[model samples]
Target: MQDPRMEDELVIASSPTDDGISCWDLHTGAEHLRYKLCSSPPHGLASVAGRFLASSQLRNPKSSASGTILYWSWNKPQPEVKSFPAEAIKPLVSNSQGTYLAGGGVSGDIYFWEVATGKLLKKWHAHYRAITCLVFNDDQSLLISGAEDGCVRVWSLFLIFDEVRRAEAKHLFEYSFNEHSLRVTDVKTGYGGCNAIIVSASEDRTCKVWSLSRGNLLKNIVFPSIIDAISLDPGEHVFYAGGRDGKIYIAGLSAPGASNSSYGNHIIGSMSEHSKAITCLASSADGFLLVSGSEDGMIRVWDTRTRNITRIFRHTKGPINNVLVIRQLQNTSPRTSNHTLASPLRRHGAPLPSPLEKFVNSADENAYVKVFINPHTTSNQHLDSSYITVQTMENQIKELQQQGSSAAAEVDVERLKSEQQRSLQMIQQWKTMYDNLHQFCVDELLDPSHPGISSGQPM
Candidate 1:
């Protein structure tokens, strides 16, 4: 036996009740660190390049200055930096290079900040409801945001930076997916950059895959219960969806359609041992283990090969909101910090190795600098070259416009416009009604014949 919990010696889990983080060695089931938190972070904690840890804390929900982001160095016991964003942000994600940090707010907005200075770089309205999850691609070129509005949108960092620098009025989103009918709980991007597939879990009891390159819906998988979280396989071949029914369903991405349904196509495997609903899930860096956190405050580590529970760690008597498996750094010495200065490397359309290969051999023991793959993989069927052309975009639009779908889309836009007008009219009518009621009350009060009160002054 290979000791089924995979390589989870550096795994960390956080509970809502404790306001503390617990790190454990999954193999031995021993505790490593029990760091106290100032406040409960919204979507758990994140580590930055093995140097420091970042958490978005919610001190008081009603206060204007309730939300604060705290940064702690690896060696220091206390937080090194504390910055109040003044918004109740729930989810936070950092880029691979550790230059930029993105947070999702309860007000359905996304805020981008520079790590070193803690400066607010950009803020935008992302969804109608609260944002639940945020994730960056391998190269940090794209940012995927999911919200309770059941919308998943992809944004280009390069384009965002350029637009901000130029102060352009027009905003551009790379892609927007509205396949989910309820709130989107989790969103994870697969290996490839532009050609990557985004798997989003929703409260609608479904998980959908959207193609980043083609900007289209590729697949929709229905689960028995609401899927709260999802983790992609290292090979990008399969994904694990944790549901409220206390089951982890293994859905396929590269599996054939016909064989997947009959010969266990998309739904390949499942693990159901938890007595409560699963709240969060995280896969090991090597893809050998799947860790799931449930409502019963139990964290179970499953062996992917054997499809069995290999280890279980009991957390606090609260829901486990976030679980992260950070790869331990080989050397303790810190690398030079870039802070908030973002110097993005230009994409030259170079192909990188697969995520599995990159994850296995990412750390460099001898070299001072760490090894990281950008994951700029592209498909031959849709993308023959690395660089996208104007003609290619036009062709894609034309292809999508086929079968009179463009007219249908136009109709949808018009319907939305009409709906907005109707809503405005309703508001105006309500305002008129309120004004009439106020005048009637004033008249009644000013009249001496009214029995409630006598007129004290001129109305």
Candidate 2:
């Protein structure tokens, strides 16, 4: 069996003017599958758990037409599904588990959908202006969004779904940082969940790092030019900001170093090779490789440690706007002998999810209520487990009992009981193991054969 880690890494890039999405093998620089008929805007491309590719189409600014989102399976070059959203979507993001997808609309509204059912779970006015970027935190519990209004907001998914909490809270968002003076460009979250740092770039020629736990700005870095995209290093030591001046600036995070660079404080260094402005940036899993897409219609893979260009892929049709680094699909592997071929009779890989709803349906209120009663009952698999606790489950059971029991509610209560029992069993098992270890240590110390005691350590 082939190790999944050894699987090939693919770099996918899209352009606003081009009609196709380009894919290339990261290590070998060999071109792979190219999905056709996609004109993706900046931050519009998304990969759904590597099962398929999706991109929000760029519409003409003069046209009043509805926005379109297309999805393509791994083996097909053509889009399998097309969705018409109410307004043009500028940014699209999906959690690591691919269970939920979110899009930022030009109308300043955010649309969130369940990937499994294509149901619009929530739609709320997220910003005063169009949202420019959206990112989920490490645990997928909080969604951090940036808008053209120069504001960055952190939203807790738990509060968003709980109507009772939403009614009582002063604001839907947990934190709002309005430090930038111009349109915000990109936002990236670090590893820690509540304590993680969020880095946001803007046309104000500044990048600000905000603390998720404290809800305050941690570091504000001034750059020479507007930053369109930023990628956080895996180690959280430094982050790379792609500037309109065709340079990728490396800013220190936890690294113990004084900024001596001429650019500004926390500006450690830069990598410059692109002739035109950089449009997008993505860091590899190992933190050593960085992939950048530029307006010069080129994609450059850099070895960050060596500060050298490892490989370059050109997108000759148009300037690259979005870039993503994802693992190669297993079924699409070249070495697989039984690989299924793309056929007109049937699509390849997973079937396309249903089209996203343009508006929230009031008829789905029952479903929303169920989700509020038990967040885990829905298909939102990516929700952090820390949010669900034994006390929370017990309280939910009491509420359900007060509301009168149906078959569904009874089943949920039974499941919660089982979970509580399992947790108690686990605690007992851990305590027994600790007792055995303690007894063993006591026996060893009392034994005359013990080296230190027999030798009279004082002597």
Candidate 3:
């Protein structure tokens, strides 16, 4: 029997030069479906829970039109849905649950939308210059962004949704790291929730690791060339940096022996296979394999342990910029002899989400509502239901208080009081019924009129 893990490994790669998006099997190097008419910028391609593929289009240098976002179904060659943003969006990211999608505009603003409703939920200034990269933390509660201003900021989604808390806080960002001198190219988060470490690469030819818990830089390693992308190892022992000099530099994390390496401190080694600048890097589910895309229009899968190229895929039309390793979708693959075409609705099962809005609706300023649901799964997933309810109600109450709407608060209090009274009345009714039943039984037993009791059968 073949291993499911090996069969499910897939590699998706795209370029900025109108080469569309190319996908291939990670193990066998066989090509899958090729999506067309997509010219994506760096950090623009995303897979929404393997349901569909989305990419932010690269705007023409002289075009004054709004930014375009395209979505393609797995079985379709062309994009099925399109969205126009207020500005040219460069980088896009989605949460793990696929409930929200975030994009960074060229105007240095971040636009957030609810995926299901396609409503623009939040828009705020995130950077001084064009935003470059955006990534979510391990738990999806926080978002980290990097930009041309050489700044990286962490944002809490909970606070972003709570208007009252946002107004009360001194700053919107939870933590801001302004250590990089040049434009930040990429940012990645480690495994821990609050204690996770962040690795950010920059055009200044350096990579800095920051500790989230301490909100400080932990290690900084200067590279031989500017790093455009980075991939953290699954085990958190090391991370790979893709440099403009066409080399994948391996830097140590928790592992030792970095001080003795010839490349420099904390620099363990390097992998050289691409002929041109390395554009992006991604690691496999297991830490043994590393995949890299390059300006030479080639994708190479390297055996990290042996430092040898295991497989190579060529994207001949343009320079490969974005690469992702995801689970293979059955319907996305080529049709076999027994396969038949499915209807559009049947292919996705659910209707496509509406087009994302360009701006927030001013008329309905208080229309935003957030609901958190716990998915029913077989795995051990623990959630504090009461705590979540309390937190949500507290935020709503705070917002009401800030609005100076005492009438709304009083109405809610009265409604809750009425509910409490009804509950107490129902409890009293149950107690009265129990007492009446007890008295009837006692009377029947003493009067010896009940057939079942047998008038003191013990005597």
Candidate 4:
């Protein structure tokens, strides 16, 4: 649906939290959409408008599975959004109007595209290593990018536009920083907090705030673990940073003095809800409220001012790889609505399950990644496709029996029904006896780390 107030609504990309994307209708408390990228793990996502969303998949281009960019048009339900092969363009950011998109991929090649025309606009061999993240300023004039080579480069997109028209270089700002023993994960520009200030994060367990004005280093906020993801807050007082240790760190930002290590920021507590790493985080427009997503597939909304968790959402099944908070609507029904990114309806403040239970549940929920479970052999399992087939066959046999066929035909139907009934009986027996099958698999994978999994029984 088109936004009535011209503010784009929320189209959350969910998967098992394991891989791919399932778009949830925030209004319905249900996931009515899925975007299955062929063979690659999806990395980043941004919904520019009501119906248009772009995603980045990370995989080897030469391998059987290649990294590709996907464009989704919801005019058709989310499932059919054809992902065109974009082996070269690993997406990073789309422009304000969603007309232009920017991303860099293998070979540190930075690129942008005109979304409607699908034409390559500005292109450059931007880095030596693969590009990690890219973002355009709110004005769409400057593009900030980070690469695995431990360098952050800023490009003047408008200047490039002029060069396209008049052939000149419009370079804006560029900086190189040491990953200091880790890979750079992401870079973001602070538009509201400081002029020409760009923030970059790396696996070095630190988030750095750079002063783009004088081409100088500023402050370094040492984080607890390898920084997995970092997002700049609106109103710029603080920025949210999370690590692989499953904690959300609120690093307060300040105008730095001449010193690079000038203790300019404070750690404004953290939201440590997940058992594993936090993969994604975003903030509301005011910076007073923020949300974080993790490999545990949970979302927690935090009140930055009070340092308290407002609401915790456990809507996704597997790992949540990407999260973006767009501030188009305010006080938009505290409830999940079609037009917003509010928290999903769930029993709040339920004493968090014991840490062990959380870990065990995470293991079970994510076991489908490589270990396939058979519902016919396990308790509290999803109905396998075979169960559907069996049920369908049994229903057909019953229908034939009720048709009042001849004696020979009835006998045949009765034989088929007897077989199905026997199968169902056996299945029920196993289901009751093997209720611990899922728990056993989860325990092996998560805690004890099984060397090999085996049902060890004939199907």
Candidate 5:
């Protein structure tokens, strides 16, 4: 099996089914592989470098078959590695180098493991409720966690391994934020390492940006609905917040009115197209595309310049819990073109009308009538010579009849006969009107009571 790098692919995961993980080519949007797992992932999906993928299953309510981590390679369907941590994990993350894996459990404890050996590196209690989100800093040195208890904590990996510092502090967290009054839904860190800004979204209907350098709340922006996910802008100037209101709000990290934005209080703008609550968000490295997943099972790719959807990928019939956009591997190319083998899309029932039908429906009915009435017109000349030619129409009717579409051929013949009759009637009416005018002129020329003839005595 050829190992693929995680950066070169777009990864997606869904729930309530055995076939869940799907990988697609980032450039071409062609699906490379689909893996069927032992169970649906609840804590979300992670790619271990480019060699394999990882998913965490929720513990089954009726059976003891879940709470397992499943790993799959690019070319295989079954998991290469499966481990049961004995606790149901909800949020999973990988280090920048993919050397280690970390998961947050329902018991509010975090577990770290070496990806190669599957050996447990560290496990500790971090929160009072299930962990909702986990993110690593740019260098993977700091792990940020959010929980249902509304506490956002930052833990340092260096300190986690220090035996001397471990004894000095009662807890290992570098900073603990308790501003949120509801469950924290998502958390993201900005560009800088230690000086980076951390933002947390919550069920409290607000997103807060905390300064890791100063250990203080930098900004708090409230929304109209509960915010579920957030993605930072490329420049780290503004962050996009997705909420239950089906809108993505752009909140500035700087102070209110400090930037060139006209909107005060850092409420810059919003992009609303999703009909359901957004569940997750991932931005491209260049920030040209912002991908968002919703409870409606739609993944929309937005152009940052226009703030409009550029492409849409429909996932399975379940709420999309995770979305990831990474760089395409430099060494790997797309396996297929989008025109050949496209990604699997969940299409709605009943296909749409063809383009020809759509164009006819959008146009005024009288315009088509005018074209048939005046076949010699410049606009209809091309169409008449090509599609409406007598030979062409006859050949098409014959083909339809040969294909057992006698009803369709009959309808076409009737339409053509009616059009020809209407054209002949219009021409006949125009000739009749012309003849009547000519006869009236002749009668007036001979009439003596006509003003010009009667007054022509001087001539």
Candidate 6:
């Protein structure tokens, strides 16, 4: 993908296909080596901060103690701590900045952990079935989770913590929906926390939105593909749902009491280029950039605005079941109260774009200016070096992809060379015309019938 990481390096995931986790670094499209986990059946994987990682796994349902959760340092080989009885086969996801992690169990319970302390801060019976998906808001006060029972729940962290601390916390809200045929596929909270809308994907081949405050199902969007995961732009305005069709779609949402977003509220763009399913998605604060990881072991970064691909999608060579974006030192100015801490985020999703580009940052909840440096560095030397590396690698990829294409559509080096020649010929013709026009404009006439007709089209 055309991401900064492709230059720095891509993250490659290689599990045993049953258990264990591995991270491979991409130097020139090939992995240098790997970071391995000793554990088996490691399903969920998430990047916490710049220094931490989190994961989880679900075992045979018939077994009582089959599910487990794990947390570790960025490059460390051992698990910091492992908890059992989690319900799903997916990895655990941390809060906005990876300081906190949340996972669901087969017992219909949700467990919360603080990464640094490895403390089981809270555990609650969240649903009646398997907790299939979960996500936290930017400020960590709100959480949205979905389950196999066709129920989506909104939780108030302030209340959960208050109840744990034995202090008085404001009353919280929760909402449930029974609108899908299969289990809840995935769930995500507001990216920038600019909105309170909770979005979820389901096996029913559709996505639904709920009001985190009132606990109401606001809209439902059906997709032609089975939505394996769903994500939102940082502005919360654009919602991206990805599925089996190997495409990610962008939709708008209606506020508290509007009609459908696609038909009534405010819904817009989408994208579908991957040949496989997209398991993970990440975006920057302004929602201008998006990074998506797929089952094909590719991670592509997109310019959501132009809807044109800008980068590579190879962070790994294995099925990347999960991905998260990490941020540090948030710079936000809050609107609610004082004492607002800037918490960075590891984004879970992104889609297409529109003209009225709005950002949905979870930090909007706390009002913090994200103090981040622009990632792009304009270096002529680096640019040349990067282009040369990319050209060589792309030649290899072209060979592979062409093999999969039909004969008429096949593209080989010879074809590229021929196309280059054609392009040069066109450039030469354009230069000749430009020269003729300039000479004609000053030299008066070239033909008997043609005077100073430089301000014109070709005869």
- lDDT by residue (tens digit), candidate 4, 145-226: 7777777776655345453543543443444555445657877777632256788888777788787666666777787688
Cα lDDT of model 3 by residue, 1-459, tens digit: 335445356788999988899887777676767889888989999986555678999668445255699988766778888999898889998776566789998888999987766778789998989899999887778889999999999998888878799999999999999999999999999987768999999999999999999999999999899999999999998899999989999999975535777888889889897899999999888878999999999999999989999999987579999999875444443324222323223344555677888888675664456644322122222222222333356687788888998966896889799879879998999999999999987887776556655744553
lDDT of 1 by residue, 103-203 (tens): 88888888876554344556778788888899988767888999889999998876665645436635457788988899888999987677878999889
Output the better candidate (3/6) by TM-score: 3
Candidate 6 Cα deviation (angstroms), residue 369: 32
Candidate 4: residue 61 Cα off by (Å):
6.7
The C-alpha RMSD in Å for every predicted model, in order, reads: 22.6, 8.3, 16.1, 27.9, 28.7, 22.5
Better model by lDDT, 3 or 5? 3
Best by TM-score: 2
Candidate 4 has an lDDT of: 0.57
Minimum summed lDDT over a 10-residue window in model 6 is located at 348-357
Order of candidate numbers by TM-score, starting with the best = 2, 3, 5, 1, 4, 6
Model 3 ranges with Cα > 4 A deviation: 5-7, 62-65, 255-258, 329-350, 371-459
Worst 10 residues of 3 by lDDT: 376-385
**What's model 6's overall lDDT?**
0.56
Clashes of each: 2, 0, 0, 5, 7, 43
Candidate 6, residues 349-379, lDDT tens digits: the string is 1111111101122544423221111122223
Better of 5 and 6 by TM-score: 5
What is the lDDT for 92 in model 6? 59
Candidate order by decreasing lDDT: 3, 2, 5, 1, 4, 6
Q: Which ten contiguous residues of candidate 2 have the minimum total lDDT?
A: 373-382
